[model samples]
Target: MKIGIIGATGNAGSAIYKVAQQRGLDVTAIVRNAAKAREVLGADANVIEKNAFALTAGDLTKFDYVVNAFATPTAYQHIDLAAKLVRELRENKTTKIIFIIGASSLLKPDGTKLLDSLLQDENAANWIATPIEQAKELTFLKLIDNVEWLAVSPQANFVPGPAAEYQLGVDHLLFNAAGHSIVSTGTMAEALVDQIENPTVPVRTRFTVGDK
Candidate 1:
């Protein structure tokens, strides 16, 4: 299958790109900087130099799936970009859109959202906006009914590391045997590709992954 990765140079996006290549899939990096994409993904990488927001339907329709891994310090841009992509793909269900969202929207065992606990932490102020906007993004996505979209949220602690055995769940926070909620970039990437290859979930729904 053909895939396009936005923010292809970023942590999650880069890992997904590499995993797609390892599977011998036709993948293209839709990034703003071609040189940096080449430097990071190697000289043989196929790249489409363009900003994610500026991408048009013609640009996105070339692939079977487009993965939005774009992240920004501004935080609110997460929802904005998701809205833009949904708007562009409205009523067009051929190319599926996959979003990488934050874990704050996942539910806890007590049926409370993880975001509720995160909001109570004073130390969360430094980077809490991201989770907040990501939660908002998921809410916005849920409201759209026409587009073929799927969202994946990592566990509480997402780190950059190699792939591992993972377990998947729908809209709840998952914990490992030790009770730690975490997942590596590689594991998330692997789950994403597996989902693309064998999609069992319905569109417009969200699922999560965690280290097993």
Candidate 2:
């Protein structure tokens, strides 16, 4: 299957790209900077060097799966890009889009959205917009029934590391053996590719992953 990963130079995207390569899947890094992507993913990495917003339906429809791992400090771009991708694939069933949105939308044990607490943090003013917009992305996806989409959310603390044992949950926050709501990039990558390869999680739904 052909897969294209936007933001392949980023942490989450790089991990996913590496895993896809290890599995010998036909994968391409859809990146804005060919030099940077080659530096991160290796010189021989299959690449589609272009701005994500510049990608048209024709570009995306070629891949069986396109992962929206795009991240930016602009914050609102999270929702903007999601909508753009959805728009490109509207009414098309052959191609699927997987989103690696953050954990801001997950529910706590008390049945409240994790975004609630994040909004209450005094120090969150700087980075709060990312989660807020990511939540909105999920909200937008939920309303679209025609597109084949899958949203995967990491734990409260998404860090960079290698893969490990992981547990999956739907919509609720998950804690690891150490009582920490954390997931490594490797684990997230494995879990995500697993779902993509196996097709267990239903389309148009979001699932959470945490280190086990």
Candidate 3:
């Protein structure tokens, strides 16, 4: 199947891109810089050098599945980009989208959103906007019914590492055996491609992945 990954040079995107490559899938890196994508994903990497916001419906609908791993320093763009993509793919029948969102929208053991606890942290002001907007992105997506979409959220302590065993949860936050809410980029990639190849999570629903 053909797959296109936006922001394929970033940590999560790069990891997923590499996994897709190893699986011998027809995967292309939708990146801003062909040079940077080459540096991160080697010279032979399939690339479409363009700004994510500049992508057109024709560009996206060519793939069977498009994974939005887009990240930016301007937090609100998360929601904006999600809207843009949905608009472009409205009523589309050929391509589906998988959004990689933050874990802030997941529920804690106490039944409150993890975003609530994050808002209480003193340092939250600096980086909290990203999660907040991502939560809004999910919220906005839930209101749409005409598109084929699925969102995947990583654990609270998402980090860079090789692949490991993982567990999946819906809505609720999950902790591994050592009691850490963590998921490696490799593990997340595995989960993503697995879903792409054999999707079980229904369209329009969101799921979380945690290291096991």
Measured on C-alpha atoms, candidate 2 has an lDDT of: 0.93
Q: Which pairs of residues clash in candidate 2, taking residues 3 or more apart in a chain or in different chains?
A: none
Per-candidate total of colliding backbone pairs: 0, 0, 0
| Model 3 lowest lDDT segment of ten | 72-81
- Itemize residue pairs with steric clashes in candidate 3: none
Error of 1 at 185 (Å): 0.2
Local distance difference test, per candidate? Answer: 0.94, 0.93, 0.94
| Regions of model 1 farther than 4 Å from truth | none
Instruction: In angstroms, give how far residue 68 of model 1 lies from its true place.
Output: 0.3
Clashes of 1: 0
On a 0 to 1 TM-score scale, where does candidate 1 land against the true structure? 0.98
Q: TM-score of model 2 relative to the true fold?
A: 0.98
Which residue pairs in model 1 clash with each other? none
State residue 24's C-alpha deviation in candidate 3, in Å.
0.7
| Per-residue lDDT over 1-212 for candidate 1, one digit per residue giving the tens place of the 0 to 100 score | 99999999999999999999999999999998999999999999999999888989888888999999988658999988998898888898799999999899999999999999999998999988999999999999999999999999999999999999999999899999899999999999999999988998788899999999
Q: Which structure is stronger by TM-score: 1 or 3?
A: 3
What tens digits encode model 3's per-residue C-alpha lDDT throughout 1-212? Answer: 99999999999999999999999999999998999999999999999999999999999999999999989659999988999999999999789999998999999999999999999999998889998999998999999898999999999988999999989999999999999999999999999999999988989999999998
Better of 1 and 2 by lDDT: 1
